[model samples]
Target: MLLDALVNTTDAVASTRSRLAKVEALAGLLAQLEPDEIAPAVGFLLGKPRQGRVGVGWRGLSAAMGAPAAESSLTIADLDALLDRLAEASGAGSAGDRSRELGEFTALATEREQDFITRALLGDMRTGALEGVLTDAVARAADRPGDVVRRAAMLSGDLGETARLALTGTAEELDAVGLVVGRPVLPMLAATAASTSAALETTGEASVEYKLDGARIQVHRAGDEIRVFTRSLADITHRVPEVVEVVRNLPVRDVILDGETLSLDEDGAPRPFQETMSRFGADAARETVLHPWFFDILHVDGRDLLDEPLSTRLAELERVAGAHRIPGEVTADPEVAERVSRDAIEAGQEGVVVKAIGSPYAAGRRGSSWIKVKPVHTFDLVVLASEWGYGRRKGWLSNLHLGALDPTGEFGEPGGYVMVGKTFKGLTDELLRWQTEYFPQIEVRSSAGTVWVAPTTVVEIAIDGVQRSSRYPGGIALRFARVKRYRDDKPASEADTIQTLRALLRE
Candidate 1:
């Protein structure tokens, strides 16, 4: 198929807000692809390339730019081959070679194709064709159930391959794609709850496990060979040999365990999250060893336990890795659940996760089967600046610059606020318009897309937690921040202190 056809379909998909329209457009495009082209076509439509990260940055792309071709002549096969060559380039003069190749390739693409290529290369396909929409499109085109398609995609951890199999192969073949011993599958995720009592009321007879403040690890072992993967399914077997050795020592011949890994202090308490991340990202650091704590098992021997309930999986985990299991219990009483949550917090852990006893594993997506309850801290913060919006939010003030009161003058001028992070989430159309109208009245300066305002307007913001950072002057940043409302009655001096946020990080 010609590359223009796919680009045109992507444009159509992005140009609409209706879910049905997007699915129809994607299904129509999928129907026209050949068997061998289905995988790459789906990848491109999803705003991803088969060859990952070809070392092409904005500077490289800008330097390689040439005038677009008057007509479209490039084929899907041709584009895929060019990307393959670019991904394979390395060593001496690789940057120049990549730039030359990108220039040659971009010169053959039309203007619309160039626009699509830029977004795809930048990993920002902003198209409405996200994973959920594309999965529905696949089901519609293949005459299969959405659940079946989702399971195949999650188990294989590759939507493009799943698309190809669903379109060209039989349903039985798709179902046969089970968990391999050394291959990584998408880990299950948890939903959030306001409190443990509410979570227990929703999911009766629940298992409340301590939510650790560490990185997620999925270990796959078969005899002496062992492989470890992160939550996003990145293979990191070489970085942590200690984890590999521990999994290799398990009694089971073949097993897949899902757990968390973190560094512990001399007192056996979990280290700071920043320290754990630093150790996790290191290529080789044998001095600081990471300990693994298993919570669930996905597979044991040749039996696949993914279809089993949480109780069954826990039993299998106890038999295989009882020594490394996290602390938890099964109960329906809200009082017990709250007690466990309290204990977890007292032990310097994050919080507790309440899970339904009979729910099977839902991979790659956050479902309500398992819910987490953590202490949410909200503070009155100052809005320093705002940025222009895009897409449906165009012509409006959207993303806000959030600051914490720095009273000690530790970072800069006396009584001046310090920037922690920026957030564009949890804003409705009314809030967007309100900011667009009210912010300029307090504006101190304006730029091309951003407006700087006096730090007099205080707004209430909620955050999951805080993390240590070097990018901001205060040395801390918020996680999953969202605006609750504008605190018009509060003064800048009454805003939350930088010390308060940094204290949360220490917890």
Candidate 2:
């Protein structure tokens, strides 16, 4: 397919607030696409090339333009390089003008250039928009599982392999076969039950494991090779050589285990999420102190135990893994798991994913399968147009703004659904860079260079809570609303309903 075709799909997806229509249009295109065209086509569909780890916004794109001509995976240094270029490109100096000229450079064809020119400036790579939504649009168009698309894209830095399978057949095909380099589809997540009775009501007969705050990772091994994937399903074997080294120590030749690659301090307790985040990209020296805490086992020696149920996987994982690899399994008792979660939080960990033993792995689905109970904090929201982040945060623009998801003078969209908030926190630097560049394409109106999006991104921010505000559009403000991370796995319809926030206010 022509790059223009994909770019048109992205333009519709990015501009219009109607996510379903965006998805339907893209899906129609995917139905007609060849497998080989999937990666670059989708890249165009997202309106930007996959710069890998250079960071997604202007910062990231700026760096790729100046990067040395070398074949390298995404790295933090790459982002810094991009940031340097972005600063120069946006500046008013002689070198800055040259950088701006570089910003206008394009490998796109003539027709493709016209469409992008009409969309936004500088190749329409403004952030404050959700790549996740665009990701969902692609998944929906291709008729593939959203997470599968995300994981594959994250894993291979290309979706050609999986997209080929999805277009030719079904999600099962992509799930059933692919190069081992790609990451596996992420399992869906469950919400935390506030009360014990609630927890019991939600998870009957299900065992619970400590909710670890450290990085959620999946370790897959085939033959003698090992690969580590983040919850997002991006392969980070090089980034986390330690995890790779640890998996190499596992006895089983072909096995897939789920766990946390916690960034530990000198004492061994889990480090803060920010500290752990500091290790993202590539940093061998800093990574030496990182630790991996094993949790779930999805596949054991090609058993495909995700369908066999969690209990069998756990037991087999323990027996096959022995004590040399994987973390010790804790009890199914909620109290025990809660204690573990508390310990993780107390030790500056993010929160834990309370999992039920014996449940089969539900790739790319979030429900009661595995629940995440983290400390609740509210963020001051600024409404950025609700669009998707990539991967799990595809639809609903779950990576939202915080000025408020509330009403503004009884105007637009029933309540306050305008683009007011923005964040790429909790997301890797690569994700952030993608958004920054993507934002301008869908720019609605607001600040000059900041590119005020349509105010649709309804992000779920983690902060202290509600506070008085006069500076923002919404009357109320988020206390510490920093983008915790993109809630890729959620739908906008399920975003923080007004009623939910009111209830919290009552509390």
Candidate 3:
């Protein structure tokens, strides 16, 4: 239950990819922990605190967190005492008394704990060590994949399910029920084609659809009540009130639809994702702002559409979703698919995710099943996990490693997978806090502060082209990889594969 114990394990899990093996390792370690340590243990690895970490941003807030336990205290326990005092202050204290009290507390806490608490409150621990990694460690201990554990964790809203499962054996019961996105159905794998002819040649029957640039959304509805979630299952119902209202007004009462929530300019061109996210913070977002475009329905009335193909869902989605239409459908013709991709790009959108008619909405699965072919304009890549960001980059995430799926092994891997390069750009003061908190979590095995992470984050890697490499994991290195915008829409597993990067070179 010591904070260090949990922190250490989190470091271990972030580096370990084998979820099943992690579970075994954690099971042994968890058995030694006390019951009281359970929630804190879970919370830490989960990338949060048991008592939601007390954060301090303002100098006043910083002062309170840094306040010493007493004249002689220096431990985190002392900081906790200082924070506890914040919750106990009386309003009767005049402004002068309040200022004095604040000053006293700030001076008492150690500089280290004070800074840590300050960033914690801000909630952007850019530390490569993140809760997702801890979730993976917990999942590994549970004999499932970290993602499987994360899906289950998100559903339960609890991470301690790991220890409980180890002792009681109920964790397996939950994992048995996969967190499906839409209708419960096995996901169909996708076929890759370097060109339109190549794509059509593989599928005996071919169909293509306009790949909108927006966050992939899956909705589950019953009557007027509906839950709008992201492909990752994060409840976005609150973030996209406009879409929720649209869902409530839909013609069908009971239905589940799949779609994208795009941010568009007056011309209907997709806006930058950051702009779309910023709008969510507006008071008007609740009144009216942002747009919802539904494209596929996985369930309608009382029937499930998993057995049905993408073609059937598109038709049904249009009918039930109303205004939500399949943007544009393309015939299986390779030349036509290419034309559509070009048009989407010229229209100022990111690129396209060419979905076949027979595909299923694969929940928690990333394959060619649903693919993203981005615009020639490379999206930005943020430095996620770095080794020292070092040398001149020391103390920063120096080397930028980028990832995206390679439906083809053009980059030479089984799938296109590669780590771009190190970057010294796109970092901010706030980002420094993030790296400080997060990088430690993802640190595979580190000495002092120097560390490494399993290349698991997707950075919009750009380049003149890729070249053979002996230093990087994907066998190729980016020419001049630097920080771009941080992406939350595209998950790490969904990052460009080495093969996909190869075509960029070929082009």
TM-scores of the candidates in the order shown: 0.77, 0.62, 0.61
Q: Highest TM-score: give the candidate number.
A: 1
lDDT of 1 by residue, 1-507 (tens): 999998888878867767788889999888788888888777777556877667775456667878999999987777788889889999999988988898999999999888777666644455657677888999888888888899999899888899899999998998888788888888887766668988888888888999987778999998888899887677888888989888888888999999999889999889875577667878887677799999889889999999899999999999899998988989998889989999988888888999999988877766788987776666668898999999999999999999987655566433457899999998879789888988775565688999877576788788988998999999999999998767543445456778767877766
How close to the true structure is residue 206 of candidate 2, measured as C-alpha lDDT? 56
TM-score, candidate number 3: 0.61
10 residues in a row with least lDDT, candidate 1: 407-416
lDDT of 2: 0.52
Mind giving the per-residue lDDT tens digits that candidate 3 earns over 76-166? 3433444445445556654345456556755654454344444333332323333444455455555655555655554443566544554
Candidate 2 lDDT tens digits, 394-496: 4323344543433222213322343333454565555555565566544544342234463334344675555544544443445555665444322232345
Error of 3 at 51 (Å): 7.8
Off by over 4 Å in 1: 377-507
Candidate 3 Cα errors over 4 Å, as ranges:
1-4, 7-23, 30-43, 46-207, 226-239, 272-274, 286-288, 302-309, 375-380, 384-419, 422-464, 468-507
Model 3: per-residue Cα lDDT at residue 210: 56
